[model samples]
Target: MNFWQSFIGGVLPYIAVATLVLGLGYKVTCWLKAPVNLHWELFPYPQTLGGQLSELLSEVFTLRSLFHHNRRLWFPSLVMHWGIYAVVFWLFFLLVGAPVAIYLGTAGGVLALTGSCLLFLFRLFVPGLRQISTPVEYLNLLFIFLLALAALASGALSDLAFRSYFISLFAFKPHLPLPGSYLVFLLLLWLFMIYIPFTRMAHFAVKYFTYHKVKWGEVE
Candidate 1:
């Protein structure tokens, strides 16, 4: 195996995983350690564990707050988030040798790509959104778009190929030459895995604390 191939397929996956775990841990630690001077008393806070879980699921799957507050951006945001969720599930099923990973990966790639494109255009052309949008936000959308495109392009291969590739990666075995599209997907995936933890993209993880602790936590 060539050095570039080995590094990309083998070494980089480990680094990306480690960075994601450690970086998120550090961010959560910082948030936990930060002092809170005031408590938010949001109305209709979920009192029971089941209620809280239901509320969390509602907010997550439906983007309930965004729909209520900013209806204009809600559809694309929901599509993008659901696409991300699908991709995550695809990864899990892929590792488990499930055939459904193929469908999940395809759906995720299409939805993510379409949603990101719409969001990027909204941020670029819409007057109100453009005014508030930052360069990093646009960059993040662009990154997702490209990553989804790569994944979609790579989805042409058999699921067995993907399963074997990942198995080789985790087992630290030499990798066979992957197709160009799959290689690109891997590269972008690694970069994204590393990049997200340090950026606002980590909001997915932070939302747990935001909703459960800050927004709905019991007042002392």
Candidate 2:
């Protein structure tokens, strides 16, 4: 295998995984250690475990709060989130050599790319969204859009080769001669894995705290 292939397929996965784990761990630890000055009591909080779980699932899967508050932005946001969900499942299936991995990856790439494009246009053109959107937010959306596009193009160009390469990586034996498009996608994916923990994208990790500990924590 060439140096770029070895590094991208082997060395970078470890770096990305390590960065993600350590960064998320540090962020969660900080959140745990931070003192709570006020115990917020939102009205009509769920009083039962079932009720709490129901609420959490609703908010997570459907982005209910965003739908209620910002209906205009909800569709694309939901699509983007679901795409990320699909891609996560794709990774699991890919590692296990499932035949369904390619479909999941394709669907995820399409949904993510479509959603990011819509979101970018909304943030750029919509008056209210534009007012609140920052340069960093725009950059984030652009990054996701490009990554998704690259994923889709690469998968189309080299479905089998890419799958074999990733699977081999997990087995401690790297494969070689991946298409240039796949290499680009791999690089972007690696960067995204490392970048996520440092950005608001990692809010998923803190949702438990936000929903259970802060939003609905029982008062002593």
Candidate 3:
């Protein structure tokens, strides 16, 4: 019934997750709506409108060049990316599939932890690649690690720290407690998510450019 008990055990986290989903949805919608008007006419491949869409879907979704470029470079990057991706889908499943509950949260948390650890290890073992790794990158992975740790800690020693907070947020409770360390970590995590599409973090999208424009050189 105290600050940590109420906040970490209350509404803050659900609000955080919901806000993240809604905000990202809005941003991507706006970007997609605004324009495909700009042409990257650097390549000479001409195609019908249908062909462009087909290629875009295949290269972008399938991550063709992200695979073809160099398996060593792309494989680990793909694992890290797809891991985050699976986490996102898992969240979406939680948002829609059922009422929020401990099982979904725990599973999602575990999955996220596994993916992030793989990425962290990838960067650590791969030489030269570290040059491209930035403070933001380390911070991002560390945030995930902490979140996973928090989830496990709460489940074991700290009971209901994150879960109760989420339930409260979703239920529109006015009062709750939040953990200080968690609050900062969540804020940074949200910032990382918000910054994703706008930054090199968008290599997800850029990989498509490499595939279609540079690797295959199929821009029209």
Report the C-alpha lDDT of model 3 over 1-220, residue by residue, as the tens digit: 5654554334445555566567656655665556344445555543566776676767544567667865655654454455455545545544454444345556556656776776677667778657677777777777666666664554521233344443445677734445555555454455555555544454554444444455345333
RMSD of each: 1.6, 2.0, 6.4
Against the unseen true structure, what C-alpha lDDT does each candidate score? Answer: 0.85, 0.84, 0.55
Show model 1 residue runs off by greater than 4 Å.
156-158
Residue 206 CA displacement from its true place in model 2, Å: 0.7
Residue ranges of candidate 2 with Cα displaced over 4 Å: 156-161
In terms of TM-score, the best-performing candidate is 1
- Candidate order by TM-score, highest to lowest? 1, 2, 3
The C-alpha TM-scores of every prediction are 0.94, 0.91, 0.53
Estimate, for each residue in 124-168, the C-alpha lDDT of model 2 and write its tens digit.
Answer: 999999999999899889999999998887774226345677677
- Show the lowest summed lDDT stretch of 10 residues, model 1: 153-162
Worst 10 residues of 2 by lDDT: 154-163
Order of candidate numbers by lDDT, starting with the best: 1, 2, 3
Give the better candidate number (1 or 2) by TM-score: 1
